[model samples]
Every structure is written in structure tokens, then in C-alpha cells.
Target: MARRRPVRAPEPLRATSMWRVDQVFLTRRGVRVEVTCSMVNDQGGLRNLSVTAPTDDPVQAVRHAARFIAGRGNVSSARQARVRWAREQTTTLQDELIRDRQLEDEFLDEFEETLSAVRDQQR
Candidate 1:
């Protein structure tokens, strides 16, 4: 009689290219990545940020963190740097939101002024 080899288990689930993506959450391996990006206007109104990434890539995990920050909140950065900055900025953003009075309004005003200056330079 011959001995049989052990069977391999199925691979864990991950985000696939076929996923129906939302602007808010991207989940994989039971890890939920919630995105909250925004742009602060000169009028003190916070606007959402846009996040983009390839779903099927293993690198998407890294992008997920950045997406979570840039998706619906006022986080800024691009590519890998975005992911790195997102981690620290996200936490600071939360703390600012919690304790600081009128933090959102202040951010909006500052952002708007900065944006206006950039646009002016671009013209």
C-alpha cells in the first residue's frame, strides 16, 4: 500500500479585479479598509478626496491604506508617499477632529487659500 500526500488548503480570499468597488470601503482577508477623504475649501467646507488603485495587485494592500485616507478625508500625498503619510496623518486628523474646536473649519479655510494660490500660479 502507498501513502497519500497531504492536501493543500484553499488560498485565503483577497480583493479581486472583479470586485464591485465603492468609494468608501475595500475589504480583504476580513480586514476592512475604510476610506474617508476630503478637501477643505476656502469657505471651510470639507470635500472628499479621490483614491485609485489596481484591485488585483498584491500591492493593492498598500494602496488600500492610502485609499482609506484619501477616499473621503483631507489627506494629501501621492503614490507610495501617500500611503506612508496617510498612516500618520489619519491619526493626527482624528485627534484634531476630536479635541480642537473648529478644526474642520480651519482646515477648510487653509486648504482653500492654498488651492487658490496654486491655481493662480498655474494660470
Candidate 2:
């Protein structure tokens, strides 16, 4: 077996410096909306970005904002994963709300039947 010399890797190009902004806005309804990040593009031009959430919770608002920005900004594996996770959470919450409403309806129907039976026995 022959010994092979290690090859050195080339240095990466210097990354361009850019100013970024992340802002949170509150609506009259107490909803917190946020912009994950805003920055100039490779062309030295600013890119327009809009991200908002109708949720009152600050944490949830930021996550939703990141989901929106991820779609318009760079397409990276990490960003895609975050977006997918946010969507899954949203779906799960919606399913839970539907189930709760159904349970409430069932309870109300049972209560009405019990009240009717008691009234008939008392008559």
C-alpha cells in the first residue's frame, strides 16, 4: 500500500456583509406579528419582505413569521425543516379544536335529554 499525501482545501470566499432587521408589530387586537429577517440581496439591492401572524402569542407569531420568510428567502434544508414543523403544528391545533367542538355538542345533547326525562317523571 502506498501512503497518499493529504490534499488541502481551498479557502472560501469572504461573505458579503449585509444589515438585517427583525421587527415585531402589535395589532389593535393584541396580535403579535414579526418579520424574521430583512436584508439586502447579492445585487446590493434591498429586497421587500412582509411577514405577519394573527396570533396573540409572541412565540407563535415569530414561528409563523419564520415560515413565511423561509418561503421567499434562501432555500436551505434547515429552513425547509422549520417551515414543515410549523405547518404540522398548525394542522394539529386545528384538529384539536374540531374535536373539542364535537365533544361540547355531544355533552350539551346528553344534558338536554337528562333534563327532559326528569321533567316527565315530575309531571
Candidate 3:
């Protein structure tokens, strides 16, 4: 009798939530490109990046996504730049929020003072 080979178990899976896709755009050449975006918190930390490429052609899409996810090539560089730009935008918005709050406080103080002056004049 011939000896039978033993079956091997699959490798463990990694965390899938680390990837957050911001958008996906296809080129004229029919190549699908996905943008894995990272969110920057108030503390300036990058929430992990995500690159997901799915299409009607499962084989091709997997190949493309794997290459991009590996951080190998221009696509990877572009994704990194995009993440940096997004982080800067978040920082700018945070600054604007602080400035607007300050302005609102000043306006409320002035309005209260004007009301008090009018009441005193009527007395």
C-alpha cells in the first residue's frame, strides 16, 4: 500500500480592521486603484492605513491589492503622500475650530455688557 500525505493547516489571519479605504478610482487603462486612507486624531496619531482592491476579476484584483499592500512601487508612495495631506487638513480644521470658539466667547461677553448698560440708562 502507498503512504498518504498529511494535509496542512492554513496560516493564521491578521486583523482586518486596520485598513480603512477612503476611495477607489479606476484608470483609463482598466486598472483598478484603491486609496487606503489613515485618519489622524487630535493627538496626531495615524489610525492604520487600508488598501482594498476588489473587482469582477477576483484574481487580478487580489494581485493588485497584494502588490499595493506590500508597499512596493509608486502606488504605495502615492498612498503615503495622500495620508500626510489628510492629516494636515485635520490639523488645520482643529485650529479653525479653536479660533471660532474664541470669537464666539468674545461676542457673548460684549452682548452682555451692552444689555447691562441699556438697563442702567432706563433706571
Give candidate 1's whole-model lDDT.
0.36
Q: Give the alpha carbon lDDT tens digit for every residue of 15-50 in model 3.
A: 332332222222222354343333343333355444
Off by over 4 Å in 3: 1-99
**Winner by TM-score:** 2
Question: How well does candidate 1 score on lDDT at residue 85?
Answer: 25
Ranking by lDDT: 2, 1, 3
Model 3's alpha-carbon lDDT is 0.36
Would you list the clashing residue pairs of candidate 3? 19-50
TM-score of 2: 0.33
RMSD of each: 18.2, 21.7, 23.2
lDDT of 2 by residue, 30-79 (tens): 34443333344444555445555677664555455544543432422121
Over 4 Å off, model 2:
1-29, 34-36, 73-123
Give the winner by lDDT. Answer: 2
TM agreement with the true structure for every prediction: 0.24, 0.33, 0.21
Alpha-carbon local distance difference test for all models: 0.36, 0.39, 0.36
